[model samples]
Target: MKLTAASIATLPPRKLPYPDSLLPGLALYVGAKRRTWLLRYRSGGGKQVHDKIGYFIPNAPEGSESLGLAAAREKAREILGRVEAGVPVAEAPIHHPKTGGETVEQSLDKYEKYRTRQGGRIKSLPKTMKALRSALADYATLPVANFTRRDLRRAAEVIADRGSVHAASAFLRYAGPWLKWLVERELIETNFARDVSKPAAVKKRKRVLSDEEIRLVWTAAGSMEGVRRDAAKNYGRAVQLLMLTGQRLDEVISLKYGDILDGKWRLKGEHNKSGRDHVVTFSKTALKIIGTGEADQRVFPGVHGKISGFSRLKKDLDKLSATSGWRLHDLRRTLFTRLVEDLDFPEEIAHAVCNHKQQGLSAVYNQASRERQKAKAWEAWDDRLRVILATEKVVTLAKPLTGLN
Candidate 1:
């Protein structure tokens, strides 16, 4: 029977075949629920093959036809034309032409484009790709298919030899997934970086700044001069917020004015590192440091994007404070440590303060979120910061952190 929109819509669900009268080889296979349009054709060698044209979806919104009768017949004609032209049938269903002589740079570009199309938008993808290209500069122009285990190992070795084990590790982390992506797409035969041993573990940083050092850095954050003064002050405020909240530097810097609402900094799961919602209560000290900005403006605007140029600001901070070898991340650890050692927060409360996920048994059984306790803890921490900042010692409930003028 010749199919129409009404006939296709009224077709009952069954494992039945509907042959198109207009196109000899085009047919629809109606399985339990889905009906897929397929082109039944023969290769030059006369081997019969069935190629999926599209799905026969009924009542699709206008302009989004997957496989209407007219379109399916047109697609079947195109497939048959290609078959008649001696185009070999693809061995794999999801076949893409192999880039046998394609360079690493080209492969990276294709990889990025593929990922973006697949909705895998990673913020660090560009920087990571650039770093990997730098590490493999000697072989970047070489064909991706020609890379072996030795080439990947050599890349790691060269990065390690430059006195950055972390960089070497990061190179492997970026390369492994990228090479695997190529392998999955049949651009390369093997993912050589997959089995390569990771570089030796570097010593973990334990350089927590002392209270005096913290005070020095805090004060120095304001005294920066020339064109960098504003940027420095911005970094200093970010540092203060990090210390007060025990959140990551990126989280603080990426904070939009909208994130501060209802007397708390609210981060949805997508914005948080833990992939869970996080709410940080504001304190008087935090409010003072956040200051006033437009509702759409960033709390700390520095450089091109959210509060960059930390390394340059850190140099000035280091020089003025006469403190060395401290990282911004260490401030998170410092807050956790002080919360326990100085403020007498319980171990679990300290962990909660840092937003670390509770592990094992506690995570499953403990349903209470301790929101009130957290508020009290932040209040205590803010009071301590006021003492350090030499502001009024009283800790009060904070209004909206952004008094945007």
Candidate 2:
């Protein structure tokens, strides 16, 4: 009358759509479509009538029918058997709030916490959560498991309507991972979202500006409106470094006075993305931009309000670009390309300034802590930058082309 693991394994295939499990009087069924696996368990408190245990699946190759029916009855038995044996599953692993009702907001909150635990980038987390929040507004009332591609597409449409294929794409990307996780944990069947396409380009268009544009922007900065002032200043510097030194935006912004030593900018343990010390050589321009002998909390602290204000910088830059016809990110792109193509900086050195790990031995085997030579490279870049900046001028719409010419 009691079930044994061997007994369950030995049972005959009941029909075309077979019940894979047998607990004496109980039955566990795998679907004919092979869509789902179900385990029928007899209630400890009740009669011969059976109740469903749960689901599980072996990970299968993508796009295979195996994944569709991946959750098998025996796997459910292991989990239920463990719980039944008085091994308490963690009080709340992932989403565990027992609720008469659940909302998308609640699930997303749980997911955000899980992501933080996984060491997902904190700066990116807020942006990711903001997108999820926007997506959930129209769909929050619906069950997360019940969400369909149409629903996802509708969310995508809304993002696209906001003129952002990128945000729409990112939402779908993050959503799929969370949905797949739910599938893996037996919180759901195969993730319906496993097939959704977000379609972002593998390589982003570098948005850094050309030497000419840099000159145009610098000339444009002084005469720009109040809102554009901060943006032009921060981005001007950021763009300069991005082109000149190849430092990431954050690395450039996170610089503290103490971090600079011997005319070099040193990234401390707190700020380096690589989680290692990074030394940025003081190119004459980098030094001139950052090296006011007077100590302050930050070099670009000239922006109004908000200490270490990146958003303010972005806001101002956006305002200026709307009028002047340029975007701040373009500056970084222009810089990366110039370093790679024009200045003859090695690909690895260019990537190093961005704090991107150099690939292959440059990234993995070499474990190089390139300090001295990198400094020289940036300094050389600075020397060239002065020549470029000195040559061109940014002109405003109010003034004719002849003014700059």
User: Tens digit of lDDT per residue, candidate 1, span 1-405?
Assistant: 667766875676666578888778888877765677877888898888888777765544222334577777877887788889997546435322222368777888888887667653364666787897798777665666656677788789888998889999889988888988988978778887768887787788876767666677666654544354366567767877887888988778887787787678876655555545567888887888887766888888775667666776676667666778888889888888888888999978877777776678876777666667777888998888667767433322222112111
Q: lDDT score of model 2?
A: 0.55
Candidate 1 versus truth, CA RMSD in Å, comes to 17.4
Per-residue error at 348 for model 2, in Å? Answer: 1.7
Q: Write the per-residue lDDT of candidate 2 for residues 287-392, one digit (tens) a residue.
A: 6667564455666443552224445544454344434444555555565567678779887776666566445555556667667657656666666667787773
**RMSD of candidate 2 to true structure, Å:** 14.2
lDDT of 2 at 160: 70
Model 1 scores what on Cα lDDT?
Answer: 0.72
Worst 10 residues of 1 by lDDT: 396-405
Q: Estimate each model's TM-score.
A: 0.65, 0.60
